[model samples]
Target: MAPPLTPADLTPALLRGALEAERTERGGLLPHRLPAWARAQNTDGQLTMAESQPSGVRLAFRTRATVVELDTLPTKRAYVGVPPRPDGVYDLVVDGRLLAQGSVPGGHVVTVDMTKGTFAHTPGAPGTLRFDGLDGTVKDVEIWLPHNETTELVGLRADAPVEPLPDGGRPVWLHHGSSISHGSDAASPTAIWPALAASAAGVELLNLGFGGGALLDPFTARTLRDTPADLVSVKIGINLVNLDLMRLRAFGPAVHGFLDTIREGHPETPLLVVSPILCPIHERTPGPGAPDFSSLADGQLKFAALGDPAERAYGKLTLEVIREELARVVAQRAAGDPRLHLLDGRELYGAADYAELPLPDELHPDAAAHRRIGERFAERVFGPGGAFADR
Candidate 1:
């Protein structure tokens, strides 16, 4: 542990989006996105894990620091029989442009040694990330924490003054999706599709992308319902289909109920329902998405759909099926709810793009695909005549 940096040490204040608490521990603050009341409702590991990752959260401030230091306690995850995952990345942005990207080396790890059907916790020393030689110029800085890992803010120090920056009138875009949106294999936090699109569109983003967790749950809908946003979008289908979390019979109503809840809070706000991006392996198949340990045994891991394609007769929700269903559902709902819109997920990353930049794991997109999707999204939704044209 190191000396604490209090609010008095920094000028102005700290801006924490979607964060509700400044939990004190070891004389430092740990930002939590879930409000106390909401956290109370979600005691299950799934909800707690999803909500605490701070997928789109960042530390934004105006500063003149020639040198900067951030201390974070990142919780890294590892599987039992697979190669270790990469260290979480921290992206530094100034004036809306990525300045530098770095990854912390040491952190506590939560190991899921599934081979034994158990898990283990290993505590490690904290690692410090320092950035210097910045020409001593004053500027706005944003430190985007890893979206795929749980990070605790221990302290932030700078050579010069630092203060929180305002949103600058940018439209706030609230987006929710599964692992792809949660930045599974993104090169860095800001490089995630939604994050990149938000940066390109010059909008503030509140991302609720969760890993295997975007199940159209009421709590998630309520979170969106209560949050203020100029625009909202939910990328549906992949997680549902891949996890086989629900059958076709439950998905349509679940989708409707999810949207209905959000509409309760944002009645007239432009809402977009996006289908899953092209995942060839799951486009026509159902899954209890299994890991290909054959590859893991060789130091890599990949996912392969386990269910039979014939299962579609049993109402399996494949990506193709999901896309068609979502289109129809949104169209029917849009008859009187014109503010709602649907985007073919393939519009962002389709069969063509996949041919070039395939999902390395047969699931999550690689960094290049993320870039492609982000650019397409900015051009579509944030561009002229699109659902979020004003944005």
Candidate 2:
């Protein structure tokens, strides 16, 4: 029989012990060694390179406010490997405290300091981090790494009996969109529009948003088709324009095909197809120019440019066009499937909201916009007795 783990056997000290042993045997976090080609199977596959690959997915928790009671302690040590970014330093925080702030080493593990307390590992590896010796409940926890880099959570532990919040009985809400849905420039993970929308609507979210990574792809459609969900939504168009990935002739059919693939798995679930919100800059702008990484590399240029004016006007994605196409597609599908639903992405975040909280770039929404998008989504799609609401 296996020996029981003692208190000393479970401290952060044990984390170091494990690391040392792994080093001796020449093995470390499994995700750290994952090949670029394998991780590339994800939405952000294009960005994956042998030198700069994501360690793995990390699960984090956040509370609205800090709780005073400490009945559980964090026992796990999570780390991620990131390629060098324009910004040299990476930021690590626990319960909002700046625990570790330093420059990342190439292909190395960066550990964050944790509060000392006892914790137990649940069924999930490196289970949820719980706090001990506190009187109140903790609401929010955050961890931020450099942009354009990859990281992973490797360990977790709690001292007291810990039960993760049950998956809301409601059906999981599956969503796919561009940078806006990927939490670009949001202050925190919870501040992302999808996160906000899911929380407000009280639904389980499987966010497949990818920054500049939302180009319609067969693999993405296949992933959506394979995953189980109660409801599903796909926000399309803007990415096609921003990335100059496809043309008007291709865009319409791509949208249709994407939906068709999703229908493979969720034939009866309510599926909402959304178009982009208003963006004057990209609305009429067309681009065929390649991303000017050369100038950006030398700091000569600040951002990439869309070079083809003809393509911009003819192929450029506009909110109006997106709305028209979405309406047409939904109307056609509704003739055959009554369970499908259609929404104008603008209902969630629009030009008017942009006036109040302008998107930092021509592409992504700011934090306030995320909140606004969440609230509007709750009122619209997930409102009382709506698709996602309890019947």
Query: Which candidate's TM-score is highest?
Result: 1
Best by lDDT: 1
Off by over 4 Å in 2: 1-149, 161-168, 288-309, 312-319, 385-391
lDDT of 1 by residue, 1-391 (tens): 3233332242114644554645655655555666677678775675577677867888888877777888878888888878788898888888777888888887889898655667788997677777766656778888888887777777788767677786688788989898889888888888889998988888898888887777787878898899999999999988888788888888889889999999999999999999999998898888878777777677777888988999999998888888888988999999999999999999999888988998999999999999999999999999998889875
Model 1 scores a TM of 0.93
Instruction: Give lDDT tens digits, candidate 2, residues 199-273.
Output: 676666666666665677777787778777788888887777666677667778888898899899888878887
Worst 10 residues of 2 by lDDT: 15-24
TM-score of each: 0.93, 0.65
- Estimate candidate 1's RMSD in Å: 2.9
Angstrom error of the Cα, residue 204, model 1: value is 0.8
The deviation in Å at residue 298 for candidate 1 is 2.0
